[model samples]
Target: MFKEWARSVRYASKFHRKQEIVTFMRQIDDLEIYANLSKFLCDNYRQALKILKSEPELKRWMSVEGIDDYDTFHVWLEEEREYLMGMEDGLPKKREETVEMEYVKRLKNLESSQGRLSSILKAERAALSDRADFNPAPISQVACRHAVEHRNRDAELVQDLEVRLGITQQWTSESPEWILAEKSIMDHRYLDALDEIERIIVERLFEMTKIHQSGTRYKMRRHIAKALQARSKAIRNAIDRYNTVAEEMDPPKPTLSWEEVVNYGFLAEFDILRDTGDSIRSRPWTRRSYRVAMDRYFKILRAKEEIQRLNIEIKRVVTWIEDEDWFLRRKEAEYKDLNPPLAVQISRYRQRRARSDYNHMQRFWALAKTPGFTGSVVPGVSVERQQARHAERASRPQTSREMEMEVVDERERWNSSQEGEWEDDDDEGEEAEQEKVSTLMYQMSVLAVDQDDGRTHQLD
Candidate 1:
C-alpha cells in the first residue's frame, strides 16, 4: 500500500513536470529556441512517465486510497515529499541534473554530426578525384580533335555574321555594353550583369538582322551570329556602366568597323610570292583564317553567357532566403504563438479551466468515503497490453503459405462468381423454353376446342 502511494505521487510528479515544461516552452518568444528545448524536455518527460506508470505496486495502492480530489492529491504529495524523493524506482530527476546530462548528450551529438559531415565530405572528395582528376590526354584525344574542328567551323560562322552585321572584333571590344558587363561581374553585381547581357543580346540581334543581306543554308549560322552579337553588346554595356560609376576612363578607341575593315582589305592588297617560283598566293588573309577566328569568338561568347546565367540564379536564390528570414521574424513578433506547442498549451489551459466551477455531489459526501480514497484513473496496463497486441498483429509477417491461401481464396471467389453468372444464363434459357411450350400447348387446346364446337354446330 505504501509503495502504491509512492508510485501515485511519482505519477502526479511526472504529470506536473510535463505541464511545467510545456507551459515554459509555450511562454517563450522565440519559436526556434522553444522548439530545440521542447524536444529535450518532452523526451525526458516521456521516459519519466513510462517509468512511473510501469510500477505494478502503484496499481495496487491506487484502489486502496480514495484520494481522487485535486486538492487532496497535492496535499498528499507535499506531506510525503521526503519519501517520494527517497524512492529509487519512480523518482524524476532534478532539473539541474537533467539539464546537465542533456547538455553533455547534445555536445556529443554535435561532435558526431561534425564527424559524419567530414566523412561525407571525404567520400565526395574521393569520388571527385576518381571521376574528374584523371589525365584527359589519351582518353579525350579523338573527341578533343572533333570538338576543335566543330569549334573552328562555329568560329568561321561567327566571323561571317560579324562581317554581315558591319561590326569588327575591335568595335565589339570597345563597345559600352561589353565593358559594363565585365565590370558588373567583377563588382559582383549579378543582376546588372544579367541586364547588360540582355541588352547586348537584343541590340546585336536587331542590328545583325538589319545588316544581313544574304541567307545561309546552315541555320546554326544565324543562332551563332545572334549569340556572339548579344555577348559583345552586353560586355560593352557592363564596362560603360562600371566606368561611369567608378569614374574610370573608357577603354582605348576602336581602330576599325566592318565596312572599313572590308574596304581596307580590298585597297591594301599585298601579293604573296611562293618559294616554288611559279605559284603565287594573292593575299595573306584567307577564308580559313577568318573561319578559325570565328570559332574562337563563338566559344568565348558561350562561356560568357553561361557564367552570367549562373551568377544571376545564385543572387536571386540568396535574395529569396533573405526575404524568408525577414518574414519569419516579422510574424514571430506580431503573433503570440506561431507554432504547435502554443496551440497545445491554449487547448490544455482551456480544458482545465472549464472544470473549475464544477460542483461534485461525490465531493460533498467525501467524508463518508474518506477511509477509501481511490483514484478515478485506471492503471493503463490493460490498455497498453491491448495496444501491444494490436501492434504485434500489425507487424507480424505473413508466411508464404498464408499468402498463397489468400490468393487461392480470391481465385475461388472469382470462379464461383463466374459459375453463378453461367447458372443465371441457364435459368433464363429454361424459363424462355417453358414459356414457348406453354404457349404452343394453349394454341393447340384452343384449336381442338374450336374444331369440336364447329362439329357440334354442323351436327345440329
Candidate 2:
C-alpha cells in the first residue's frame, strides 16, 4: 500500500512479453521477478506473520494453521501481487488489451464453423421428431442447457485453438467439403465419446465448413466433394440412428456401423448389384465379416425404408437378446404376432420365404427388364423397391457363355497368327535359296550332262 511498496511491485511496471504477459507473470513461482517486492515483504515478514496468524478466516483461506503455513503465506504473498495490486483503484491499470484482442481473434476464426453446424443438428432433430408415430422428446434440458452452455464454451474453445494454432484470420470455407472434415469432427455423434472432444472439435469444425454453400476463394473442387459429403451424410445419419437400437428389436443384430461401412457398403451402387461388396471389402471397416452385419445394418435402417422391414429387424434384435434360451425354446409366444417365426424351422421357413421371395423377385426382375421401371434413386423410395431394383441385376448377365466362347476363339486365332511369326525373320530368304539351289542344281546337272560346274558344286 505504501509508495515504496508500489514502487517495489512495479519498479517500472513493465510487462515481460506481449501476449500472455499477465499469465506468465502470474505463473512465475520464484521470488526473483519480484525481487524488489520480496525485499520489501521480507522487512515486514515477522509483523505480517504475527498479525496474520491471529485471524482464523485468513488462516483457513490459506490453511495457515499447518507447518507449511509460512510457505503458503509466502507464496500467496508473492502471487497475490496482482490481487493486492487490484485493491489500489489507481494501481497503474495493467489491462492487457492484446490478450483480450487475441481472444476476439479466436472467435472470428471459428465463426463459419459454429454457424453451419448446430443448424444441421437442429434441423435433423426437428425432422426426426416430425414423422408419424415419432415421438421427439425435447432434448433434455440438460442437453438443452448443454446446448446453450456449449455455445459459449465452443466459442471459447475455438478462440483458444486459434491462438494455439497461430491462426490470425478466419478460414474461408473454400469448398463445402473443405469445411466438412472439420465440421464432422465437431459432431458429438461422430466422436467416440465427449471426452475425445478437444482433439476432434477442430476436425468436425472443418468438416462442417466443408459442406457449407458459401466457399472461399482459397478452396477448390471442394464444392463437389462437399456435395458428396452431404449426400453421404444424409444416408449415414439414417443408418446410424437405425444401428443404435438394441439387437433384439431388429431382424438383424444391431452392431457398430461406422460411416465407412454404410457409405461404401449400402449406398454405393453396383454396376452389378451396385458392386458395393468390393468397396466394402476395401474399407477400413471391412475387418469383420459383414454379411450378417449387413443384414443387421439393413434391418436397423430399413425402418426408414420399409416400415415393415424396420419392424422385423427390431423384433429380431430384441428377441435375440431377450430370449436367452433361444436354442432350447426355438419357438415362443413373442414370435406369434408378426410374420411367423423362422425358428429351428429356418430351412423350411427359408423354403417358403424363398418361394415367396422368388415370386416377388421374379416379378421385380420382369418389371425392371420390361424397361418401364425408371432408374430412380429417390430419397423417399421404399427400401424394398430399391432392393428389388438391384436384385433384378444381381446375376448381371455375367459376360454370357457365348461371349466367353467368342473370347476363346479370338484368343486362339491370335495365338495361331503369333505362332507362324515366331521364326527368325532375318534369315528366311537365305534358307529358302539354299533349298531352292539344291533342287535346281539336281535338275541342272541332269540337263548339263555332268560337265557343268553346278553338278560338281553339289558335294558328294
Best by TM-score: 2
The whole-model lDDT of each prediction reads: 0.38, 0.37
- Give all TM-scores, in the order shown: 0.13, 0.14
Candidate 2: regions farther than 4 A off? 1-152, 172-460
- Residue 9 in model 2: lDDT: 47
Lowest lDDT block of 10, candidate 2: 370-379
Q: How far out, in Å, is residue 140 in model 2?
A: 20
Per-candidate RMSD, Å: 43.2, 45.1
The Cα error of candidate 2 at residue 222, in Å, is 54
| lDDT tens readout by residue for model 2, 49-127 | 3433344444353343242343433343344344334433422222233433444444544564456557646866887
Instruction: Give me the candidate number with maximum lDDT.
Output: 1
Q: Model 1: per-residue lDDT, tens digit, 91-142?
A: 2222222322333333334445555555645655676678776444553455
* Deviation (Å) of 290 in candidate 1: 60
